[model samples]
Target: MVKQQQGAGHSAEASALGFYYQAFFALLTLMRQDTDNAAVGIEQLDDVDLKVDGHNLLYQLKHSTSDAPPVISLKSKALWKTVKVWVDILPDLTLSETTLHLVTVAKLGLDSPLIALTNLEAERTELVEAMVEEAQRVLDARAAASKMGKALPHADRVDGCSAFLSLTDTERLNLMRRTVIQPGSAAVGAIEDNVAGHLKLLPPEQRPAVAMRLVEWWDRQIIYSLCGKRERVIARGELQHQISAIVSDIEHDKLVPDFEIASPPRDYQPDGMLARQIQLVDGKTSDFSKAIREEWKAREQRSKWLNGSPAMAVTINDYDLVLEEHWSDRHSQMVEECAELDQKGKCQSGLEIMRWTHENAPSTVRPIAQGWGAAYYIRGSYQVLAIDLKVGWHSDYAKLLGDAE
Candidate 1:
């Protein structure tokens, strides 16, 4: 067993590789394309990485029990290196739809699978083989349909995540117009027009020979959608975990440039596309942007709460319990310090003031050193009560964080 504590050690990038690998199979299957079945084996995580439709992907797969974190910071810092590498690959090839993505997937180990087959190896040495065969079948079906002039619609890429062009001519052209496919973009033409050329400019030495290797890979491998038919439930769960982690980071002041959660996440519609798009998103970027914003707000609020209150308190008036808090230690300390300055004769200056909260906290909260103690804030013709003070002896940060009732 590993250290099972909050903010535990990192996991490996390989955890996500399975999902990305699945995605590759999905892509191949979707394309109605065919290729060789064997891994070219230039090396794993060395001389070669996986490229699909010209996009380079780093797939990190981890088991549930795995205890390594993927190289998120390393990849972010080394982006320029990858860019230079991409520059080396595009010159002699067509990389019109290329992009780079770093993916990490956490998966269940092979001891349990939905379909249990005896003699199936625990190492899953045959799983990839089976997946490839299934992918080919899916591709063949697609090919047969396409030949009959019946093709399925492709999904649009989620922005800030990945970009994908549709198999249909109209959508593909529109996507092409909206994006530049080359490495020389931003330096040359407009952002949209230049992306394509930017990709095409990759150095010839790194380019895959389109006539054989690219086609062969396409034939041999297949990609399945990142989302399965059961994706809605999985998406909700994954999204929640993702959102919660981000919220925690913001609360800790760890997320830079700030994180905010917009009211909704995406502009979804009932039976429209994403059922909750509008309710879940706001502004230009929608869910991706909106979610982070709202989460930031909640983090800020929590920081504010934690600052003003303590885990517990001893109080008069029957020792009333101030159950939940929403402030941070630093901010609350500053608030108390300002109050102390006010109590003493250390008068006026802008530094003497923080953001003006209500002149009074609720009555249940009596001021103590924790700073989160409550009092009454004036309401029109009345006073409003807050949750800042504790009258009783019970305290739980879990409840404070909303995990407990």
Candidate 2:
């Protein structure tokens, strides 16, 4: 075995990085249906050890010689510096359009008070699980939000978002009773309010359509994301994050961010993209993050029914999605990649993403929508990525349901 050297615990650090590489590979396999983007290629960017799709991931594997676990920090400041420096330089080496990220894998997984691979206590596993879930929460939400606004005539956007957000908070204590979401409860409340306010403002003409679009998007795009949210909860085991202002539409056509009254401190730096990603990681956690997404969709659905035609309003909140600030890194990555393949340059929008997910994803991913064809959508997370989606009703009701379902 390689011994620990004086150079920033390179041995242990590299081992942790290796584990991240494996996990990420598995995640990509699940993410990429055709295995193209999933074919990650690593290159030495000035010998600093840059991963192909290894940004904003979190994780720490552990092994003990005799007693318990390791500490959070792996080694010396130089080691931490190595990571920080790589993060700073990665942007320069990344694909001009793709967002580069810094994935800091913690080697503090084993022998600690909580969380373990084998005989670890449930509390420990849950604690570590909490951290992992928080990060995933960020990734999922970010992906959705990055594709909002420019949505087509989806029917479920508002309702799904509304219900999911509401349910998330209502059950936070239960989901994270063994973790730290309590301290951030106030933040959860703020997010719910923010989502509610924005969803309420969806174009009065298109509420139900958007709500349904939210649910459909989730089924297709996120159902088997980079890291499936199945039973296991492990970090990138890393967290995908981004910083976003919970802006509101006032008298003017301005999207004014509302951080002064939220849990996240308004002083967060937003100049650089990386800084924003980190900020989002802290803001949109899983405990409340997933719930918020579902709520936004639901809200859109409700809006459609309340304001528009009653029965004809057409509820589709079952498929819409909101941007998770925390997981914005992966979220942004996927959206942009899909946007590029959208084939229709500059046509990226809510409708576009919805159309793509519905048309491309397996039948299980299809969402409920009204009208005859696909929909167009804009960024639901950040202000950049957008895409398309297929829509309408099928003639063969029984066969279509069986096949689709």
Predicted model with the maximum lDDT: 2
TM-score to native of every candidate shown: 0.20, 0.17
Residue 273 error, candidate 2, Å: 69
Tens digit of per-residue lDDT, candidate 2, span 272-312: 32222222223235413322333233334345444544553
**Candidate 1 per-residue C-alpha lDDT over 1-405 given as tens digits, one digit per residue, 9 for 90 to 100:** 011111232444433333333333222222222222212211233222344344433322211223432222211212223323333343433434433222222212333221211222233324323423433444456567778899632111111111111123343232223221111101101222222222243343322222122322222332211123231111222323433454444345341211121232355221221112212112134432322333334334334434433432222112222212312332344445555454232222111211112222233234432333222211100100111211101122123322211
Error of 2 at 249 (Å): 60
Give the winner by TM-score: 1
CA shift of 131, model 2, Å: 20
Model 2 CA deviation exceeding 4 Å by range: 1-35, 46-69, 73-79, 84-88, 94-405
lDDT of 2 at 266: 36
Worst 10 residues of 2 by lDDT: 180-189
lDDT of each: 0.27, 0.29
